[model samples]
Target: MMITSRNTAKAALFLILTFFSAASLWLLLEAEFLAITLILIYVGAVMVLFMFVIKMLDTDQSTLRAQFTRYLPLGIFVSIIVIAQIVLVLNAGQFDIAMTGIPEKHDASYSNITAIAEQLYTLYVYPFELAAILLLIAIIAAITLVHRNESRSKKQNISEQINVQAKDRMRIVSIKPKSAKESK
Candidate 1:
């Protein structure tokens, strides 16, 4: 029992450390775009999502039962198939394994940011703009929808809004001058 618990803790720690290490490796690869995306989208967002789900389900490593009877064989089979496929693909590919620091032209001349912008604006302008518009519309719709409640008065009348006038908020004040009283 003690050994199993220790193993569980070790496994959990290993999983967490591996997740962080993988992200760090991505950062070291000089692929800033991919690394930041992995950290921001995967590590930050998905980790939080998983934590929420774990809390919601009241599941911890200790309490969870490992039901390997039904799924173990299937999992092993699938994993082996995936590994074999990956191995075959990697080994069969004619990818250039040359460790030449960077392509001669690119290392000295390629301005990645400028090139990316040019490609994005010239090649993917319409789609990028459309996506931006869609995101904007979604954000506006979400903000509009999130505030909807009967607690707020029912639907507003556009006519009532349009009909509003200065008189509605006006106040009349008399400008009377003070008269001096005569002493008898």
Candidate 2:
């Protein structure tokens, strides 16, 4: 259904519906929190973001159709590579439920969020910090890439910016008051 949709809005609607279905499945599995989180994150936030991005794109159907054939070969190659990886992984028995050990049932007093937080903050602290630093570096690199040097920039000068006064931007002309008889 999503693949055949030519309209971006329709595609987004399909994606939102898919998220809703997955959330419903999570609820059926008795993970109320997971279902709610899925709905809130994907349907509420991500779907709205997708809509905003699609609207901002401001693309015409003709332009999209024109590029479709141009990238078709690359898309097909990527799809084939993805399918091959899936087949290899499936054949490797990594995802076999029978081979995997049964999960231990949690005690009624145990909180899922607390356990996750403990693992993340204690056991995985270094790795977590490394990931954070990597993300920070990525952000800085992106900023650097977008930051034009003073020579390339046409922005206003800081000196000029600070020295500006309201009087410079606005002119208040003084005029003598005229009587109604003089005006006539």
Candidate 3:
């Protein structure tokens, strides 16, 4: 019933290997942004969260493979199917994606990130702006949900809040000296 450091180290190693595999896939797909995000978000945030939860639970053992006994045969079957599909895909040759390495010549128009950005804003502007709006909403919602009011401040009703004007908070009463000076 005790957790061992060896199991923890193994888990850490497995997570790192998974992250690297995913990052390698992103690179193969020519998606630089996705590869970087995978490393940053998965390796950085999710792995850190995993370690924190594990440490908090003081786990000496994991129930990952042991708890899912009923699904093991199905899992193996599905994994075999997936591996077969991947093999088929790798062996199929439909797309001509290679450049035959012949001497090439072209106008020098593809020099910098600016050119790519300009094309993206013009050609893919709608999706780009939509993504920005989505990200903005996500950020705002995250901020709103995270900052809960845990303080024990007195709660006021809506009518009370609306009725309380500036006069309730402050008052400027006429002084007795001003009245006496007027009489004199």
Candidate 4:
């Protein structure tokens, strides 16, 4: 929905809501940490950033309409393929992979959070760090892009404004007070 949406603001809003829904699903699956992280990172930070960027940037809507028509046939084909794949997956219900041994059931003492944290920090540390790095890069790129289009001189200088004297703002000229006698 976000990808195909015509309005950028709406798309950003949709993306934020989608992330929240996915987070809710994760919470339902007992993945509390992942859910919270998704909310904080994507909803709290990234989505807001995307909205700000979209609002700041100027868009040409006419170009979009032209492109939409050009891509309609290909888009419809891809959409049908995607829908078919989703239906097939739903009809299958579950994967057919056979477990080599019976899986261990969680006991009353087992901590889901602890287990997740252990695997995430120890086993998946590199991938986790890489993702953080990627996010950092994206932020830097956004800042650079916005900054590139703005002139430094246009930025306000508080010190310069405060230090400016009356002389700099106006000139007090003593033009002999309009002589009424000279005005015939």
What are the Cα lDDT values of the candidates? 0.67, 0.86, 0.72, 0.86
Candidate 1's displacement at residue 147, Å, is 13
lDDT of 1 by residue, 102-158 (tens): 433335454545766888899999999999999999999998897877586677889
Point out where model 1 deviates above 4 Å: 1-29, 60-66, 99-112, 126-184
**Displacement of the residue 156 alpha carbon in candidate 2, Å:** 11
Q: Give the Cα error of residue 138 in candidate 1, in Å.
A: 10
For each candidate in turn, the TM-score is 0.48, 0.66, 0.46, 0.57
**Tens digits of per-residue lDDT for model 3, 115-159:** 557878999999999999999999999987766674654666899
Each prediction's total of clashing residue pairs, residues at least 3 apart in sequence or on different chains, is 0, 0, 1, 0
When sorted by lDDT, best at the front, the candidate numbers are 2, 4, 3, 1
Q: What C-alpha RMSD separates each model from the true structure?
A: 10.8, 4.9, 10.9, 5.5
User: Which pairs clash (backbone N, Cα, C closer than 3 Å) in model 2?
Assistant: none
Alpha-carbon lDDT of model 3 = 0.72
- lDDT (Cα) of model 2: 0.86
Residue-wise C-alpha lDDT for candidate 2, range 1-184, written one tens digit per residue: 7778999889889989899999998666556677898999899997999999998997699999999999999999999999999999899997787888655565568665676678889999999999999999999999988894757777788999899999899999999999999999
Task: Give the clashing pairs for model 3.
Answer: 3-60
Residue range 54-122, candidate 4, lDDT tens digits: 989887899878888899999899999999998899678465445244345655677777998899899
